[model samples]
Target: MTDPLQDPRFLQDPYPAYARLRDAAPVQRVRTGSDGLHSYLVTGYAEARAAFTDPRLSKDTARFFAGRPSGRELHPAVSQTMLASDPPRHTRLRRLVTKAFTRGSVERLRPYIQEVTDGLLDGWAPGGEADLVEDLAAPLPVTVICQLLGVPEADRAAVRGWSDDLFASGEPARTDAASHALAGYLAWLVAAKRSTPDGSLLHDLVRARDGEDRLTEDELLSLAVLLLVAGHETTTHFIGNAALALLQDPGSLARLLDEPEAFAGALDELLRFDSPVGIATFRYSTEALTLGGTPIPAGVPVLISPGAANRDPVRFAGPDGLDLGRDAGAHLAFGHGIHRCLGAPLARAEGEIALRTLFTRFPRLRLAAPEQEPVRRRTRLMRGLRSLPVTW
Candidate 1:
């Protein structure tokens, strides 16, 4: 049991840990010393998928935290997201907003996504070479999400700042500050939508709230915040990771560039090769149970590693190899079963368009510093390059 977070081995390539854990102990108990945090790590694809769909494994931590010393309930604002609840609450809320996340709904915005992507590309100085991350990856998705959620285009910068803060799990003080800022901003937006409804996802959610009795006001606010933050953050990393994967593999990148119609298969491989959300959100135990021969006590927290599952040898042949033509629809990058990410289609479209357009625009693009491996974010929950410096 090493300090998984600080262990460089886990950082550089977690596949070894996943390989060992999957083979020897798919479910292993881990203790957090004095923090009083005890949990299980589910590493295998089948076991992880089962846990994902198990009604006994609750996504809502509120029940588990009851009478506990955790300060989670101290901030009612943060604990009120659909991701933190189970059915019928989770089912109801997800259904109410399903229209905004459908494949058809997201595809309708493809033309707009292209326009947004191309607009950002137009702004970049090709030969001068800019950080593909900042110049393109970050802005394109932010713009699309802002426009979709009805956030005023002028407020994109501020919204992005808040999102960065809320998802910053590394520093305690920073995470708290970001949480407050993001929550405050979302509260303001939710109130505005109530008074003046416009045609956007936020507006549709607000209207749905009036039309249905399933979601409460707080639940609606939390859902809105989740949609905005999760919507952009996950896709942001996907764009960066996917581009890095394709660039690192010349054969795959060249094929996609040579045949523009190959975006679909290439996108799947990119997702499987380097997932953006490296970890599943959180699920708690409902009752004591033995999983993969490891005993998990009731009410304990568990973190499922999706990135590891994507590379599971049992599930993928040459799991580490980049095969653009392989069938990758079974990849767990989007989690399996009912709780799968609602924004999958939107993310796929954005990733495909951004990656294709990026390479097409600058075929000679190369890392600004070839000697250094790109630094990744410290959070175990998400995988993203801290900064990607590039030149044409």
Candidate 2:
């Protein structure tokens, strides 16, 4: 009976709801507010981990929705990506992407990430107020992703708007429109790269071929859209979420500020304390299976809550509290199994650079109005603040 999406408290701070779910019903069925879709919400750390790698649960939406009128059609842009496929297909797609998304590839972009971070911070005058989400968190990752994808600066705003709509809730028609628009745009972008390639990941993907295996036109478009949307959105929220966490706990913020070398470990704790992607993408049961002693019927949709699992007290001592020194290396913030985020390295680098640089530039940074609550994003797929107003 408890609907997390309908509850404002849950949207604002889901950790309490996650705690309740983990204790009472680790695997409980709930209907989504937007489309009334029924799904099993897994909250326990162990349960979520098992579900992530479980072969019984499937990511192939086409197979799961077969002969079912799911209202809207599954756009190739949505269905053809590695996020929506099973092994062999997912393996091939991931292989091609991994070649370009390697740690070294992302490491090469560190200077650019730092440059963008510094430029954004430079606009914020010391002892003046600024919206951290707008001036820093949002634009920093967007610029990095746009540059990496070879997206023109003039088109970044439009692309960001489309990306927002794709993850938004409540308006099914509007969401469809945005999805189509992004897919169409990526299709054109892929074609443009064919004639004159840019030395970007999109270009590398366009040219990627493995033993006579090449990405189809639709696959190329879907992959590009995925990279662009997923690559930026995760990091954008991460910076905001991490910054909010630090701002609220001056002790931890001070520790990181005093010990610059501690940012790496502190970043992991921040991710565990509040993940950007609250829930992993949808997965369906291929056959009846048991998760945390609860039986899931065949063909039922399952949603693994990384946000909840990361805060499981059984897995983490004093999980609700954020300890910068906590060993959070095993957190499921970037997900688990074969479908883990490909852009995690890039996101981690961006978070560290953005947080470190922002604090260094404004040592006395604090929330503009500590009494006022920050706005939370409405979508269940992501957990992030809309804006974080701050001043020094």
Candidate 3:
């Protein structure tokens, strides 16, 4: 079967196609790349949840490419991160930074996040139109993450540019250039943090490294790159996708306007309705195994679609429709098991603050062109609006 992932129409609204795929079978093989390679796409809610924990499915990028040379160099910046590893390595690397991202840590930033949201909104001209993505969604998370990561004010813009370029799908050369640029910049930042240690998170890691040598130089730099990029990108798009959905939904918009904090309570449903990351990151079958009753061969890539599975009819009644009051905790917007997103609490806090503040301030906020489909970024694994023009 053909993958509709890159098609313009599918990017606009992929649920309909996703529904058809899930209906056919929870697991189906489809050509997922321009090279005509096939990967098993998991769309069933139960199957996806199970696949996340299945030991037979491995997320080890370095191991997968070890003997088979892809005829290209693997950027250590991209390859050495915990995100692409398995077992003891993934666990060890994750433990290093997990303390800083706990719920308590993220909640402490609510006030600062609110202040940032207000500052961004303060710039919007009253009653005039603006792209929410550029003005609000993108900047809010970027600013907060940069602050926590100790990225200097002057360097943040460059850092964010590199992060954005890292996700520019369909452009391999651009992606490679960005990976190298960000890796180099982060190496400098890490060294600087070591020389003049402060209360920042990076300094803490540097201190940890000095004491026990828990991680290597490559791991340190790779970890920083992963955290910096993953920190903002998801929250940025989460806010964007959620805000755009609410603008298109009058009833939801009015409800949020009346009691903005309700947006926080509705986050699970909001994430379910339109996930920011369309699919979970890389995974491949380590041994031939059955997922959702279909056999997947060893070495074949396996993709789990949170976007599709969140709307599986068996898992959620009327899943396509957005129901703020619905119980959506089971949704897989954040992947299940060990590989679940580390920054989830941070993302939720940012999303809630950003959405609540946006609608509360502009009660009459609306899509500038309700008739036109919003322009969407075409990255293979991410789902987000390129711009969301809105007016009050």
Candidate 4:
């Protein structure tokens, strides 16, 4: 069976294929890799929501990879973050990390976010062409995350480079190398924070507490790596994807530019219409179970498609169109369950500010190559554009 998820055409625009998959069943079994293994994708909104919290599907990476030799030795930072852990430990990590990574922390970043956006836009002149991905979309979040996390100015470019390589798909060697490099860098950052305490979020995280239960060395290191990698990569693409959608829809762009406040609600629709995280990270079934009424044997790998589920016609009216007016709050752009992205509020704040500000300033913004298809990156887990060249 062909893996629709990896097809180049499907990557360009996946909604049509997703609709067909949803029509076939709420859940679809498909070939996910070249290794001849099969995985279940919960594509319907309801099933996807359920699968997120299903106790039968364990997110523990050690449990999933036990005895499965792949010749890759992942760093603890790569293998043991909140994304890869389940319960009790997940609870503790989230609790401690949350103490430092608060919504208030995100709110404090708003002024700086605006400043960065303005600075990036300044690089391009009015009535000129620019790659939105490079000029505004990519740099905004990367700069903002480094600011929010208190990463030093000296290491910002290196940090961003490592994150880009870490998330670059289909390059296992580079990916593994990035994993160790980032993990090692973060380990040093953590140690530096301990000896010379600073006022940054990373320092706070190093000193984060939960009734005297501190994050162990591994937990702290992994969480830092997670925040650094997960923090900026998807978001760079998210701003790109959202900005591209608006460029293609002048009417929608006008609505946002005309009324800045409208973006607060419209961001959800944008997220659902073109999810940043196309598919939730993989998890393996802890035991045999029935999901969306489909039975699966114990230990089968599973994936949840936010891209497919968020656009199911039954759940969303005219799922293909971009409707900022629709109540899109129920969308699963951020996975539902305890493992939901911790950086979600921050991402929303950044997205709303990024999109609203970009169009508001560049009122005549448009695609540079309207006749050619947009180039999407080659990764199913995170759907984003490679570059969104535009002119105003």
Each candidate: what lDDT?
0.80, 0.89, 0.87, 0.85
Q: Predicted candidate 4: what Cα RMSD to the true structure?
A: 1.3
Local accuracy of candidate 1 as per-residue lDDT tens digits, 227-269:
8877888888999988887778888788888988788667777
Clashing pairs in 1: none
Q: Model 3 Cα displacement at 89 (Å)?
A: 0.8
lDDT of 3: 0.87
lDDT tens per residue, model 2, 131-235: 999999999999999999999899999999998888777676778888888888888888888888888888999988887989888888889989998988989
What lDDT would candidate 4 get against the real structure? 0.85
When sorted by TM-score, best at the front, the candidate numbers are 2, 4, 3, 1
Residue pairs with backbone overlap in model 4: none
Q: Return the TM-score for candidate 3, rounded to 2 decimals.
A: 0.97
RMSD of each: 1.9, 1.2, 1.5, 1.3
| Local lDDT at 331 for model 1 | 81
Worst 10 residues of 2 by lDDT: 72-81
**What tens digits encode model 4's per-residue C-alpha lDDT throughout 193-286?**
8999878888999889888898889888888988987888778877888888887888988888778888888988999889998888988899
Residues 191-249 of candidate 3 have per-residue lDDT tens digits of: 99989877777776665532364767888898889889889998888899998888878
